[model samples]
Target: MNPIRDIVILCNNRMAFPAIQTLHSLGRLHTIGLPAENEDVKAFCSVFAAKAGVNLIVMEKLKLNIHLQEIVRINTLKCVFTMTFPWKIPEEIIEKNPNVFYNFHYGLLPEMRGADPVFESIRKQKHESGISVHAIEKEIDKGKIILKKTLPLRTDFTHGMLCTHLSYLASYILPELFTLLHLNDKGVQQDETLAQYYKKPTITDVSIKWEHQNSKSIQALVNACNPWNKGAYTQWNGINIRVLEVSQIQTATEQAKTPGTVLEINENNGLIIQCYDNTLLRINTVYTDEGFMSGHKLLAFGLKNGEQFASI
Candidate 1:
C-alpha cells in the first residue's frame, strides 16, 4: 500500500472548486499552483491549501519552470491538471515531468475550444454545453480526452450561471477520470475537422449592435453578458448602458419604425424596444451610472417613449 499523494492542480478561477475539493477529499491532491499575478485567486487558494494541509506554490512567469522542477523533485505525482491557466507550459518542462498532465476545459473540445468558452457557448446559443477533461498536448486544448459530459444549456442561463454549473459538472467527471486512469486508458484523439476555436474576447466583442441584431440574438447577447460584462453594451441618448436582463416579445407592436426605438414601458414587462426585422425585445434590467435598476425605473431617469437607443 504505497500511500504518498500524487496529483497537482494549476488553477486560476474559483470555478475549479468542486474538482479541487474532490481531489483533496480523495486524498490524492499533493500540491496546488496558482498564479501570483492574481491577488484574490492567490489569496483564496492559499487559505484552501493551508486548511487542506497541502503544498501551495505561487507561480510567477519567470519562476514557473523552477517551481515545476521543485514539484517533480519533492512529490510522488501522477499528473498535473490545469483549469483556466492563462499561459502555456513549456514543452521541455512537460517532457521532463515524472507523469502526465491534463487540461480541464469548460466547453466541448474540437468544436468549442480556446478562451472564455463559457461565455462563447451561451453567446453562440449552443443546444448543449459542458466540460472536457483531456491529456495536455503540444497544441493547447487539442488534447486526448479522458472524459466529456454535458448538460442541457438552457436559453436563459447567464454566463455566470453556466460557468458555475459547469464547475459542478466537472466534480462528477473527476471520479470517472480516476477510474479511467486506474485502467491506464490512453484517451482518444480529437478530430480536427470538427474544431472551431474562439480567441479571447476584447472589449469590442461584447458590444450590442442594436440596429443589426434581431430580438432573439439580442436577448442571447444580453444573457451572455449578465454578471459578466454587466450586460451587452449599448447606448441611450449617447450615454453608455449595460443591459442585464431581457426577453424576446412574441409579437412586436404592429406599428414599426427604425430599430432601437423605445416603443413602450410597463410595470411587469419593463421596457419594450424595437429590434431589427421588426422584432421586439423587453428590457428587464440594466446597469448605468445611476446604478442597477429594473428597466421601468429608467422612466424616472428621464426615459420616454419614442426616444431612440443609439445604434451601438
Candidate 2:
C-alpha cells in the first residue's frame, strides 16, 4: 500500500473544510491558511482557519516565501501537495523534488472553465455540469484532469448550494485521486482549444434586462441570481423590487404587449408581464431590502395592467 505523507491545501473557504477532512481521512497531514490584506482573501482564510483549527497559518504574499524557505530549511521532503495557495510557488520545489500539487475547480475543463460556472450554467440551461480536480498552473483553472465527476443542474439550485454540492463531490473524489497520485499516475493533458472561459459577472450584468428577454431566459436569470445577488432588475413604481422568483405563465392572449408591460395582476395567481416573442413572465415573489412580499402588493402600488417597465 502506498503511504501518503505531506499535503498542502489551497482553495476557497467553501471547499476548505471538506478538503481538510478528506485529506486527513486519507492519512495526509495538512495545514489551513491565514488572513491576508485582500479583504475577500482574508475573510476566506479567517473562516477557513476557524473551521480547520490551530494548524492554520496566516501569511501575506511575501511571508509565504519565507514560510516555504523554513519548510524547506527544516523538512527533508522536497515535494508538497497544495490545493489553492495564491502564491506562484517555485517549480524547483515541485519538479526537482517530485512534489505533487493539485487543485479543484468548480467547472469541467473544455467547458465552463472560469470563475462563475454555476451562473453561466444556469444562463445556458445546461442539463449537466461538473466538478474537476486538476494540476494547477500559472494560468487559472487550466490543467490535466486528476478526477472529474458530472452533476445535474437542478432547477432549485442557488450559487451557494451549487458550490456546496460541488465541494462535496470534490471531497468524495479526493481519496481516490490521492490513491492514483501515490501510484505514480499523473493525469493526462487537456485540449486547450476546447476550453471555454467566463469572466466574473459585474453589477451591471446582474441587472435584469426585460427587453429582448423571453420567459425561459428570465427564469434562468432569476435562478442564477437567487440566494445571492438578485440579478438584472428594474423599477416597479419606484419600488426597488429584487426579483426572487419567476415562472412561465400560460395565457391565451396573443396580443403583443410591450416587453416589461404588466399584463395582469391576479391576487390568486401572480403578476404576469409581457416578454419578447409574445411570451409571458409570471413573477412569483419580489424582494426588498426589508423583506420579500407577495406579488399582489406590487399590483396594489398602481402599476396597473398595460403599464410598461421599459428602461429609462
lDDT of each prediction vs. the true structure?
A: 0.85, 0.68
Per-residue lDDT of 267 in model 2: 88
Clashing residue pairs, backbone N/CA/C < 3 A, model 2: 10-83, 10-84, 34-58, 206-232, 207-232, 207-233, 208-232, 208-233
Error of 1 at 26 (Å): 0.8
Model 1 residue 223 CA deviation (Å) reads 1.4
Candidate 2, 19-106: lDDT as tens digits: 6677666656455554365467567656645664524566677676666555554342323445434566665654534435566667
For model 2, how many clashes? 8
Q: Per-residue lDDT for 1-312 in model 1, tens only? A: 644579888889888878889888888889889888988888888898999999999989888888878877764788888988877887887777523788888999888998988888888899899888888877989978888898899999999999889988887787788889879887888999999999987767788777788898888888888886899888887778899999898986677878888898768768999999999988989899879989888888688889888755
| Model 1 pairs in collision | 110-195
The reply for model 1, stretches above 4 Å from the true place, is 1-3, 266-269
The window of 10 residues in a row where model 2 has the poorest summed lDDT is 74-83
Task: Provide the clashing-pair count of each candidate structure.
Answer: 1, 8
